[model samples]
Target: MTELVALVPAHDEQDGIVATLAGLYRQSLRPDRIVVVADNCADLTAEIAERCGAEVFVTSGNRDKKAGALNQAVPAVLDTLPDDALLLVQDADTVLNPGFVRCAVDALDEDEGVGAVGGIFFGEEGGGLLGLLQRMEYERYALEIHRKGNEAVVLTGTGTVFRARVLREVRAARRAGRIGGGDGYYSLASLTEDDEITKAVKTLGHRTVSPDGCWLVTEVMPTLPKLWHQRMRWQRGALENLRDYGLTRVTLPYFGQQIMLGLGAVALGLFAVFTVIVLVTVGWQGFSLFWTAITLIFVLERTLTVRGAGRRAVLLALPLVPELLYDVFRQLVFARSLVDLVLRRQEHWVAT
Candidate 1:
């Protein structure tokens, strides 16, 4: 039998930690060991993890961030791990499907070269409008990864599994200066360690896997303000990591994916607004053709995304303006992230 360790890095997540650990306890293919690294927790995160049957380790230091927590825990867990064991990394706010562990382990067994595996995350129960939007956006991200087929660059940390040997080899390579950043240390001068580490794994010619069967239930920010913070931090971390790794060459796809999508959508929206302005300024006949075309495109796109999210999501489509407004938020977030990256601004960890 293969041994598996589920490593959860948590800080001040008292409210949701127990539920997440409970979910892990209910997994079909139970892990051999469950370790929770509680970094500078002011709440009951450590106690809850221990109560839920996780072997808890508390870290003390100024480096209380997620990366720092992982750095402390990974080494300890690896010390006692079997040669072919699996290391599953999870966020404290995340819950998993009953079969999540089995699915991940099976995927790793099937693919000899697969270094890591991740699954889709369904949003937490009970959500408001903002929460719903965040869920849709997250689903869109998952779909993109799903459609990409086979190897993915980064595995979502919410629920990711790494082969023990593969991760050990990655650590060795990092210590040898074969990989640039985040070899041994988790918080390596950048705000985003996951992105950097996954890229490094790929650099070593190992594949990151995402199987269809692996599933995890995760939470989205419950409020708008929280959503904004979440996006801002995520975008900033991404941009900062990109800069630190000198990976500008690979940024074209990211730009094309985000910027082009936003620009094209917003451009059509602006064209519609301008056409309406011209019609009111002159006569309806002046810009009728342009207005009709732009309106049709806008409606079609929203309808598609809404319908794609299913019947419940389609109801929210009534307020067509929200989609347009979301684009504005996206632009702001991206712009701020760019500025922060350029200025070398540092961001502290904050829960969304």
Candidate 2:
């Protein structure tokens, strides 16, 4: 019979290790085996995981970072797993919904075309206003994803389940030069390993998904600096990976998104400057009914988008100023990433 095995790749995650493991135990469809791959840890992460009844694999002199850690661990773990076995990769700081594994397995079993099932993730509680904004942002993001269709655009790093055979196929594709990212299940060359792997799976004619109730809670950056670094890494990695793959059937829509992002940044900047110049150069012409109506409609759309985030999020969204500022921040980050790509800037990564 086939089994589901888990790999929790962690680095210096003592604070969240216990809860992560506990969440696994509480799963409705628990994993048959749990292995915590403690990568370059200088804390009690491995010890704590062992006490939680998980087999630990400590990385030896792993300088390639998270991708390297998983590269070393995935093959070793796959060797012991049967060809039909399932592999679940969950982050050290995420806790899944009780029915997450059950939902994912059902999804995979229902369709042979689907190669992986990823978690729908929300920000964990705390971090004050920044946390609340992120939660609201995630709500709007999920809404948009579902609006287009409940397709999984990215097999998020928060959590994902894959068939062992698919993993091997991805490795084969990498080796055959069908895809980039070295000759491993995950590419060490990629700053965003999860995203690159998602592309790899799709390139090999396998579909991935994020079904309903396959949800998880993950950490949010607590401060602006932390958020900046996290977003920079995410944006830069995504652009670089897309560059590596080039325009194709799968990456065409993604490249379109990047193009739109660049245009949006330029358009937003010009619009703001023009508005300021108009107000100063001329007198306050007073609000026209047409413009007021359009503005109100835009505000309503923004407010309603985050309704699923709860009453507080709805209220915060109504004002729109906070999220607007946050959006401007994100635009700046995206613009910077584009510039960095053009200049071929030095590589940088911030652990989130």
Candidate 3:
């Protein structure tokens, strides 16, 4: 029989630890074992996890952040499990729907080609308007994956389940210089460990997906500065990972995505310049009825995609200006990351 095991990598997440653990306990198909890997915590996170009846594996002098913590914990935990056993590597701050584990595990069991099953995550509540916007963004992403027949561009870190054997193969491939440098299940050098590992799995001829019913709610940055940093890290890490791997069968789509991002940024910049020119030289003309109708159609499409997010999402989408501004914010983030890549700027990893 295939056993289910969970490894939660946490760092000073005392407040949210209870909710995360509770989510696991509420699972329809609970893990046979739950271990929390507390990495450099001064808070009561470890004690809380232990008190909640979860086994704790406290990290020792580990400074490599989340990836390093996982590199240490995954091997130690995998050592105790059968190669066929399934491993759930989830963030300490995330909470899954009751059926998430069952859904993900079933995805793996039903398909031999899939190496990993990741969550379709929604934004957790709080953070005011910023949080609401972030939720809308995540909802659109969820809709995209759902519409694509559950194909995933990356195995998200919020929550994911992988076969122990596939993880072993990932580590083995790393050691043999097949995918991801250094010998570990995750790449410490890459800022986005999840994205790098996704590439590694697909490179080894295994597919990854975000199956339906595998839902999770993850943290969103409360402020613009924090959100900027988080998105910058994501975008920069993606750019760096693609650079490291170069153009190949596994990375072509990724490259195309980066290209689209660049083009979109350029287009936005051109639009801003055109608006300025029109305002100064051509003078202010009344809004075109035709353009207004076209804009409404665009907003309607956006609203339709996020219909699953509830009525508030529809209400928010109806007001086009706010979401358009938010889109510009994202475009700016992408532009900054592209600039960093061009200059070959080195950024030290800071926990987000």
Sort by TM-score, best first.
2, 3, 1
| Model 2 spans > 4 angstroms off | none
RMSD of each: 3.0, 1.1, 1.2
- Candidate 3 — which residues are off by over 4 angstroms? none
Span of 10 residues, lowest total lDDT, candidate 1: 247-256
TM-score of 3: 0.97
Give the winner by lDDT: 3
Which lDDT tens digits does candidate 2 get at residues 1-352?
A: 5699999999999999999999999998999999999998989999999998999999889988888888899999898887778999999999998999999999999999999998888888899999999998888777766776667888998899999999999998889988888888898888889888888888888888888778899999999999999888888999999999998899888889888988988888999999999989996998899999998898899888888888888888887789888989999999888898899998678776
Write candidate 3's Cα lDDT for 127-198 as tens digits. Answer: 888888899899988888888899878899899999999999999999998776579889987989899999
- lDDT (CA) per prediction: 0.75, 0.89, 0.91
**lDDT tens per residue, model 1, 35-123:** 88898999988988888778998886846478777877888888788769889999988998888899888888888888888767767
